[model samples]
Target: MLLSIDWIFIIEKCILIAVIIGISLVVAMYETWAERKVAAIMQDRRGPNRAGVFGILQPMADGLKLFMKEEIIPNLSNRFLFVLGPGLAMLTAMMTSAVVPWSSHLDIKGRMVSLQVADINIGILYIFGVVSMGVYGIMIGGWASNNKFSLLAAVRGASQIISYELAMGLSFIALLMLTGTLSLRTIVEQQQDHLYNFIYQPLGFFIFLICAFAECNRTPFDLSEAENELNFGYHQEYSSMKLGFYLFAEYVNMFISSAVMATLFFGGYDIPFVNDISFGQQHGQNVLAILQGLSLFVKVGVFIFFFMWVRWTIPRFRYDQLMRLGWKILIPLALINMLATGFIILLRNNGWHL
Candidate 1:
């Protein structure tokens, strides 16, 4: 006998994937606009307002310009890997969002609809796996450029990411200890009724946030692209849209990291007083689900703004200081936090009220 398949579910999954990829691209594009506007405001100047109303069309214009520009290949570079670098960077940046829970869920035509693209049981592991792979993009790109500065920057970038990932993973271990699950959805659900993880895991949250900045190569930790010293860093030899992709991927990674932070520590889509304001009794499930989704977006937006704000406000760190901070400070601090969390949990389990 032939088995029946759920084509509707397949179509829904495809639509969700398309929406996520589209959102990531659009967010990355407009982040350029947002960054320029923020920098202009900070520096006391007018930002891009020439292309369209309030420069809303600037990203589109920029994309068109990049597309129209001639692609340049450096004479001594490895042509294949040079071309592959930016593509890999952009791909890894986009892939990290696949397992994040965008919102709780919605009741659609009597079926429960999950807001995430993928609700894999190993959501946190999946995020870490994809995020860790992003370094290869930089390493490959920089090596392929066939330039001394690019190779140095690539080595620095790879080493820094690897160092920070250890601290980042340790911080997650504390959260996992508290939540007792690696699934992002389970962690979010746990945060719904009580305090957000940020309250209890403040140190872990801080370490994770800083590590995220390093992972995404943001200012204060953006040694990989230190223009004055390294001459545009890893993508120094790239031009046109290839160059655009490298820059664009950085912002996309920043945006995704912000979203991940919000989801992991800021209660995801659970609003304060949401439980008190009964959804089934008043607004109904669908409307309530929509509100939850909106709440999550607001949280993600605030985090993104913070990311841009820091980029404009803070100066990049010196290389030695960056290494010292990540290794000597953050890693040790994360370990201490984990120990404290373990002690508290052990005490609580034993009925010790202190």
Candidate 2:
């Protein structure tokens, strides 16, 4: 029965997975380099120009350094969970990309092949579930380290992520109501026929964007890793490549978050102001697919740069302030946005009748 099954499809999916993972790792690696360069430009200093021209090889050098570093596991730590922590973080970071629609379909030997790995019905929900699981990685790593500071940071991270997720889910409710579908590809298709969801749900988008920062443990919301307070935060006891995995997972999460934001609010692979179907007809399906892929990456790149820019420009938020903003402010706003969206949708369905 297995042999009779469509092995070609399985092979194609495996290849796609490999390609996507490769691309993600490459992007995450360079994000470290880009972060430094952005900081340099903003701070008016040379960032990294030693390893190669403009220090293009710096990320490789850094990776090599991490690989060569001594791996040290605390004697008091849980050996199994200690090793699993960063691996889980890296795994969850990459998992979220499975549902993201990278581009329009590619015509491969008269077959229409989707660029996305899985066009699941509940793509958004899958993202949320995976993102929520990401906290477990931090929590386990912190707890297993057998350090008070690590535990405290982990607790802080867990609380912060949980608090903001309420606002994030509520904000997404408004978008789901607007799109009327859980499938991400369908949502992108719907946007192609109309204005981007951002126009309709700017407040929701704002809330989601803020929540995304918190979710990814990025600046202003990066209370868990507050250097001054927690002494480098949850992974304090970690060293070598394990520590590298935790840090590298962060950039991967950032990349995925940027892609999600771009897909949900900005139209995933759609070229702005260009009629995609017409272009595909004018050119070819494969050519069009390539351009659309480039378009999506460009959007993702812009968001990634914005993430780096904000990190350099904004300081980390106080824990109290972060909690207050997430619970008191963003939650209420998200609820209001959801209610207002539903009300508007109901009215439009009834021709604006009372």
Candidate 3:
């Protein structure tokens, strides 16, 4: 059995998982710094310059502060569930990254090394199921806090997630009809040569983008975290690193959602308008792989920026407005988008020409 083991393959996959997880943690940490820098620039003020050369080490400082804070628990809170809540939220957030194709395969000494952790056939379904479970984190945390405010925020968050997920799934159904496969790797490979899904599914992309905001509870849609009414929202009672986990989970979710969006609509890891295979032939395979990975991160970066920009630029939505947008506007538009995509696919099957 030892002789038959594919040591190289196992090691390569292990390295990939470790690298991906490390990158996620580091990026999520830095995103806080970036958010502040972006906000400061937009407001014409300096931000976080005291910690380390323009606050490059700000995230680490924040982590240290949280770690050093006094751990606090309310007298009436459920001890077990209160702690479990943030951990569950973080676990679900990190789990979504496993299905995403980070980059093209690497040619490693007569073997191929894939960057993805697990490429199940029902990849999209797995994503949907796991992401839906993320609501439990906030719900449990809020309910266990034994605070009316936290409980209310949890209720609103769960409802908002349920409402928007419907539209989000409908939007993806249109893309599924186009690709006819749930494998994210297949989707990326299909769009290898200047054929991004966004070009074909613009309406679907828009619907998905909006639903993504609602799903992630980003601003304009962060009704759950509305400080004025909810008094610091669901994690209001959490302290120290426990509270840090909740905030960190949000950034992690944003990063993973950005990656998912890039993989679905954008040509994941494919250099736009450039033939990657041809470029690899010109350059070396390793060089090409590095470039493709960089391309994916660039797309993710733009999306992350968009998330922060919207947070600062757009005003938060009222509770009623948030519900109306999801149920009344987004769901109807998603239905239309799905219907249109089906009609186009039908016409194409019937040999209808453009």
Candidate 4:
């Protein structure tokens, strides 16, 4: 019986992993389609409707093109690391998904199946670590390419991520104080019972949101790939599927970052104005699980749209301006937010709790 149970557990987890990873890829694919449609709408032109209805098949077509394109390796490049670069970039982007709780557990035949891949105690830190490591993809590829422009782009990307991650970590300190736990599950649960983090940590959320954009290398902070200056930047010499891997990784990062924001600030999978935790106990767990999961994705979709919107709306920031914003503006704001949160928590603890 124990062996049977263990096999069942393994199967359940395998299914969940496949579903989440598949969903991430599918969402990433459509985000490219949506981005073009959004850009077309903004520019008052028809978007990609030629391939399939409303360009639904455009991503597949693009993928096929990438696969069919002639693979190129610059004669001077480090062949192994050149290959490792995109793979590493793609790996780091997907790694962040392991800790995200997609929804409350579903009750299946008296066994609870968790929607998350992993419930690591230090989920947020895991996300931070993986995201920080993503720059290595660009760095490795650029250095391997034996191209000066690519190397420059890699350095810019590395510097930009490092600068923003500092403020990002500082921003989270305020929320961490309120939740008092590093676990993403705990954070989500606390929000379900109490108020969402954003309600109390608006300033922290603002700082985090901006840093997230910077972390994902979105416009207004995408100086790393500034075309005119860097000549297509890191991966400039990459071709075919390798280039596709780099582009695909960006969209994946954006998707995961959006999901992270949704989980942290938007109450994750908690259904609003309802006691979903209690409702699950009284009602059917399966239904509640689905609804809660849907709620989380709804929030994620909104964030993704917001990301694309900002890309079309905002101009890219100059390198100096980007560094100044991170160091001078965002870091100071995050520090202040953290300090204030600590003071408030102390006050509430010492006879100030209502």
Worst 10 residues of 4 by lDDT: 1-10
Predicted candidate 1 versus true structure: per-residue lDDT over 310-329, tens digit per residue: 99999999889999998999
Per-residue lDDT tens digits for candidate 2, residues 162-263, read 998889999999999999999999999999989999999999999999999999899978888888765888999999999999999999999999999999
Question: Scored by CA lDDT, what does every candidate get?
Answer: 0.89, 0.93, 0.92, 0.92
RMSD of each: 1.7, 1.2, 1.6, 1.9
In terms of lDDT, model 4 sits at 0.92
**Stretch of 10 with least lDDT, candidate 1:** 272-281
* Candidate 4 stretches greater than 4 Å from native: 1-5, 281-283
lDDT value, residue 230 of candidate 2:
56
Assess candidate 2 and give its lDDT. Answer: 0.93
Query: How far out, in Å, is residue 147 in model 1?
Result: 1.7
Residue 85, candidate 4: how far off, in angstroms?
0.3
TM per prediction:
0.96, 0.98, 0.97, 0.96
Candidate achieving higher lDDT, 1 or 3: 3
Query: Per-residue lDDT for 276-322 in model 3, tens only?
Result: 88899999788898999999999999999999999889999988998
Candidates 2 and 3: which is better by TM-score?
2
Worst 10 residues of 2 by lDDT: 1-10
* Residue pairs with clashing backbones, model 2: none
Which regions in candidate 2 have their CA more than 4 angstroms from the true location?
1-3
Candidate 3 residue pairs in clash (backbone atoms < 3 Å): none
Clashes of each: 0, 0, 0, 0
Q: Please, what are the lDDT tens digits per residue for candidate 4 over residues 33-122?
A: 999999999999999999989988999999999999999999999999999999999999998999999998988899889999889889
